[model samples]
Target: MLFSLIAFLGLIAGLLYLATGARPLKWWRPDTLVAHDLRTLPYMLSYPFEAPDSRQNIIFDSASAAASSPSSTTPAPATQNSAGAAAAAAGGVATPPNTPPSASRAGSHAQLVSTPSSASIGTELPGIRAASLDKLVQRLTHHSISDANFAANFLMTYRAFSTPAELLEKLIHRYHVPLTPSSGRGAATYDKDFVHPIQVRVCNVVKLWVKTGYRDFVNNPTLIARLKYFVALMRRTGHEALADAVIKSFDKQAAKFAADEAAAARLAAGQVVSPASGPSSPASSQPGTPRPGTPVAGLPASAPSTPAHGSLATAVAASPAAPTSATSSPAILKTPVSRAMNAHIPSRSPSKEEIIASPIPMMPPSDLVADITSFLNKKQGSATDRMSRYTAMLCSDSLDALEIARQITLVDYELFRAVEPVECLEQAWSKKDKLTRAPNVLAFIKRFNDLSLLVVSCIVLTPDIKARALVLRKFMLIAQALRELQNFNSLVSIVAAMNSSPIHRLRKTMELVPEKVRQQFKAIEDLVGASSNYKQYRTRLHNLDPPCIPYIGVYLSDLTFIEDGNSSKVEGLTNFDKYRRVASVVREIMQYQDTRYNLVAIPAVIKLFSPDVSDELGINEDKAYENSLLCEPRAAS
Candidate 1:
């Protein structure tokens, strides 16, 4: 019985050692071990597995303590997790969350005990931890539905964060990581099903990178060579279709790059460059002659090839030769009608003689104001009459707010889309010389300011309180319509105008506004309110799909913040972080620029909102306040 008990105890001990992977007692081990035995033995001692939540709390507490300490008052650097630290040691930045350890090192001997489940990978994306470069790349190649969108954004903005060489290196390293189990001890082994998917995804990511950001490769020969190397590997591995796609994209982008360079050269040489037909033919480049298709100043590209109605030249020629006055120089027209007509002219580069000629007589400010007012009245009659005409022209049912909103959207869209990417570079729109430096951006901003002023003027200039209240209500409905149409630019302008001092001070008029309208206006105010740095507006903007006209001021402010917050370079290398932030914002702007509103343009409405007409109608804040006082004078103290 004693012998049987001893044998049973030995059997139990052996089973326990096998089940738990426990080491034998020190006394049981041989004094000298073979090479195979040493290789099989784990190098590091294993510890009890701790829950991720417990580990996370510990890290957070340490970080919080460090942050709150008075002795270390300066802002702490980005906290690097263990995996990130490991990656940093290997000549890279932090490893992104959910990335495998094998890819983090080039020839690392460290082993992964277990692979994370597929479901757990990429589930924590877009979080702070995932902002790391490696995380971004991992997410870009992820199989999640949102990965495509994330990839596009990263592609658009990656230049700010990383260079082509660094990114390509990471991508190649990730692709070459061993997916199959290794015969060597302690080597990682992923599921066979998961392995194929990851490899395929890496290839897909490369294809997408080529398709979306081909410009990077076009501008850099080194990148193209590296890409070819990757492609050669892909071909060797039997990924012929994917390899073919990559090669084809490279060829296509290379051709496009060559064509673009040629076109730019032609443009620099004072030759016409057609968008559709490439560089203009030699026959079209007659010296000193502008191309017929060339866009005229202050006119949209879609404007009629013929001269505008009542063009300055026609008006000047048709006017009965007015008797010359000592006060009126030949260059200066006397009649307000003629002056207003001449103001609509498309300005062009002045000829040598015109530039050197005697200056035109300047109109006194009072006379200028009088002329503008008279011109506006003659063109559209009184404010009330103009409102009626606009309402009639824009709305089929006279008060069809949706149609009014659509018309405003169409006009705003035209101005918004006309702004070029170059106009916003370096905060050109905000500079003192913005008129020349950023003509398109300045024009867009000017329209916004004018629209805001116009809204305030319409309310305060109304003689009757009831009519003013009705106008206010109409604007409120238009704001709501703008919101629905995703025309946040115009929506904010109208909202701001309604909340301006002149309009807001009208207690009686505001009292007449319906509760529904007031509530709607309140909601709009909440949406666009400056509180919390316009967080609500930004959130709404993010949730919106394409074909949106985002408030330009928000993006401009973002660019400004990026420019002010970060240095342009670090250690003589370009500061890609700043570039990344700027590119992210600019990418959004470019995306919106490409998406157009579906609403049809109305010629009458378009003319009404034209820059010239808008300037004439856009009263100054002081004038608006004066009108407000006239409509409803303050009670004597």
Candidate 2:
């Protein structure tokens, strides 16, 4: 009787395990249930034993902390696609209380579902499936960035390290707290200093996975889903630059994979897989036959032995047949047919590496000077003609005007890159360091002053009220576009012109300005205003996509503040921190320096508005007074 009782108890335990429908235990049995049923079975088995406080089942106790942070809490509803019962049993994880069910669960499952649920357990056991990769990603929302970083690094050694879907989702879906450092003397000044380290580390890891695990990521449904999620998140969060990089990397990998497969298929089919070559030169003819350039034995003495460099081959290539426009050298004309053939063979587009490696072509000081001279010399057109052309360029699309502004900024960047912080103290240009930075710095000042003059001229010279209003509207548009382009220097210059005493004193003229235009101008003024160290502008720039041009003055101010606040040397030892701090600011400018701006030159537009006069101050108080007097009706004599 005792032996029978023990055997019956063991049989009962086996029945309970089978009822749970665990996948590992059921491997040898013929599977009768679908995946959905299998997932549901475990929940059914646990239902009787589940306690009332099921919310405690989550892998992490984030719910309570999430509830406390009212400002940052935005819990996503639990997804129906989660492993259901098995997931719930794995951890006490439940969807947050009071959240609505996901819209996706609104079909047949909607009828079956009775209660609202919280988010599913993002954590999964190692070696389970792609779901296991999410274990590290789920940690990103942890209170400590270091903890998240540690989890990410430790997970790299796991057999199921990272899935593209899991990585991408983490990048886009994870909770993030904005970095808002205080401006106190003892506190860090930069938002980056306080940013979650997980953001940086995870980015590096994703890039690595994409590079090394290309096959796993390419054409995978899971990765595609992640890519879509990433795009949506970028739009919502305004962190578009990060999303742009990920998408670009994905495209590159896909294209390379396609190319490799095509090559492999050709090779298997016994077709030539070598890169296509251009037509062979005439000189490559068979040795026995009269080679190209070798006179045939039967030819007359007058007949040429070889094709002349400027013969049909060359003339055909120089289609216009104009020597003045074309190069005359024999070397240039050599193998014209081959050169022409190769020209038609379109070259592959430059890869991202090549683009980043290539430097921005520098414009010489002489060329810029010439452009300025031409702008000043040609004052022949009526004010209307000049203003109309300038306004058209300002409103032009595809960032042509903004590109010119950035080119000017590039000049400043190059000249100041090597400038020492100490040189800023020298009022007089006596030191070599000061001289090195002076030209570009001085040119920048001149350029700024010149823009102000142009602004004043536009406002003062337009005699008609309606035309002046139109001119102001264009200037307003230009300012708005500059803000969008992140060209702070030009943005401030435009705003300064509008606020110039001369322009501001036009009380009647200001009234003529449309209310919409005036309101827009005020908004721009507020953005560039010196409140909170230009916090509004900085926030806007952080969200903007690159190939952006920054306002250099802000960076210069940072350098000044750093120098003034900290001593360069402490106790006769070199203060590396001060140097490092200054270098960081400089590096920020450099990152934005050489980005290629896709802009087409509108010479007519550029030449018309190019900086002409380099005078220090163009807002002549007296000239402003004269304009004010002119605008006001004369007192009755």
Top TM-score model = 1
Question: Which residue pairs come into collision in candidate 1?
Answer: 96-135, 160-576, 160-580
lDDT of 1 by residue, 1-637 (tens): 9999999768765753453345342322121121113222231121111112222222121212222111111111222233321222221122112212222222111221101222223332222111345544544544321244345445655654577798887676555433222222221223222323444566766776765565455336577667766765555444545555566655554454344344333432435322222234332242211111112133233323232221212222322222221121111001111010111111122233322221122222444334334544477567567655443332223335665566566556645755654455567677897775567676667768877887887677677777777777888888997888788998889988988889888988888989988998899899987777777776676655555778998778867876776665444433333444455466557655544443332223334444555555567899889988998899999
lDDT of 2 by residue, 509-598 (tens): 778777987888899999877677777766665544444556656766765665566554443333323333344454345444333333
True lDDT of residue 374, candidate 2 = 48
Lowest-lDDT window of 10 residues in candidate 1?
A: 332-341
> Cα lDDT of all candidates, in order?
0.50, 0.40
Runs of candidate 1 exceeding 4 Å displacement: 1-399, 417-424, 432-439, 591-596
Q: Please give the lDDT score for candidate 2.
A: 0.40
At residue 537, candidate 2 shows an lDDT of 69
RMSD of 2: 25.9
